[model samples]
Target: MSGIATYRHTQKAPLGLLVYAVAIGMFLGAWFTDLQSVSLILALVGALILILGSAFQQLTVEDEDDQIAIRFGPLPLFRKSVRYDDITDVEVGRTTFIEGWGIHMSPRGGLVWNLWGRDCVVLKLRNSVLRVGTDDAENLASFVNKRLQTEERE
Candidate 1:
């Protein structure tokens, strides 16, 4: 892994998300003394947010050997790798907000592994397509293209 060229991208938690988390915590604290049922509900919602937020905290793109690897973190909930030989094309593209986030099937066909953002690098493989969301969409696509060219030469 030391020699491999890795492009790591991570998104800082948005201010809005932080504010929402705080609000949830405040509500839970305030209701703890009075309403047990309401406190339990808020606790569950807060837990869900914490879980999802941690899962979408970062994205990493790596070029290793002859394969392109993409991973979402701070948890390894979604990860994928495609060999240069298997990829037909790589293009920088955009994803609609409607597509949401996480690992999902794109409406246009293919799997989308995203943390949070519209910019993406789409990979057309021999059998299926894969979209990876990243802030450096162009750079990622260019890196993949260069890898494919090198693979073809060797």
Candidate 2:
């Protein structure tokens, strides 16, 4: 793989952060009381909230011998791959908050940039799916399109 790049969406919403902060305060307050059990429960809940709020996502790009491979995650260990050749079209666009952010499996419209508010170019592939990634969507689309067109001509 070559020309690798990775990006993630925003960390989490402010409401989530506030909830965790309140839980921490409550847990500490309970610690000064006779009920150690309350503190333990709060601590566990706080931990879970923090983990859920840290909903970070990742995107990866690698140059295959004759194509490019792109992947996104719900989990880093589990990823989907897309080849440049299989890509039928590419376009730069937008992804709104209405559909939420990150690499969502059930996106309302299409694939999204996730972290970056502006939607990057999407690859409409032959396999009946779309992919979104790249720091510079326009340039990446041009680069890939030119490469593919040149290959077709050859």
Candidate 3:
């Protein structure tokens, strides 16, 4: 028998829906109401927030074989194996405050996954680079690193 293990990251559906609703409300209110600057500012901010929030909110995990992966939008970013054996080193770090969340060219890094909150694990792989984001990401990174070390010694 083959054993398969799956870890599904938390869904940001509720948050996404809420952002959508807020954006729509702001846009509609701007069109209907007389307040110009207030309406325009709220409308723009709401639209930006909706788009950015939707993009950043995501989940990441590894299967039983320790293959790390991330799911964003309707597609999988990479199918490559983030296995411990393939990973040379795993580091936990956060983006600088200078980098804003969501659609910015230079992401300084507060958090990539805005909905889930900022915390990421950088995996130094043999061939490529991989990063996984999560709220408890530091702990998760430590957990995986320790397990890999144990396996390596054995």
Candidate 4:
């Protein structure tokens, strides 16, 4: 999360198909096969596929005055926040191909909160780091740097 006076952005990801794909696949598998033992479990879990889809359908980033907040939405079941004071540095960067999407622990150390693309704003914290994927990486990085400069002056 990047602290700000006012900033908000949402990045969309086309992951909503889980609602139909998962449920339909499970239903079809159960109907076409005799994997009865696990079919019931699959069917039950499949019923909740909408939640899965919504969870990763989009990502929203905003300023919460003292911290930056990022969330995976239309269901925002997962999120991360970073304080302006905690950020030691910020820069616009890109993730490697292996980094992939969604939230994960970075192989390079720290946490990665990504939705889709590789464009991101990397922030170095006091004891950790965060790579927040965004389509507006340049603007985000610039805004964060301004905030950091302001914080230093204060």
Predicted structure 2, TM vs. truth: 0.55
TM-score of each: 0.79, 0.55, 0.52, 0.83
Q: Model 3, residue 82: displacement in angstroms?
A: 2.2
The model with the greatest lDDT is 4
Cα lDDT tens digits for candidate 3, 5-29: 2344554544666767887887888
**Cα lDDT of all candidates, in order?**
0.75, 0.55, 0.58, 0.83
Decreasing TM-score order of the candidates: 4, 1, 2, 3
- Higher-scoring candidate on TM-score, 1 or 4: 4
lDDT of 4: 0.83
Per-residue lDDT over 1-154 for candidate 1, one digit per residue giving the tens place of the 0 to 100 score: 3444655555443443674576578566746757887677777777776666666667777775667778766667767788889999999998888776778888989888876778888899999999888888888888788777766776
- For model 2, the stretches where C-alpha displacement exceeds 4 angstroms are 1-58, 71-78, 105-110, 131-134, 150-154
Enumerate residue pairs that collide in model 3: 95-109, 99-108
Off by over 4 Å in 1: 1-6, 11-33
Candidate of highest TM-score = 4
Q: Could you tell me how far off, in angstroms, the CA of residue 6 lies in candidate 2 after the best superposition?
A: 14
Query: Candidate 4 lDDT, tens digit per residue, 1-154?
Result: 2433577899887656645687789777666667787778777776677566778888888887778888998876998888899999999989878888878889898888898889999999999989999999988898888888887887
TM-score, structure 3 vs. true = 0.52
- The parts of candidate 3 lying over 4 Å away from their true place are 1-15, 22-57, 73-81, 98-116
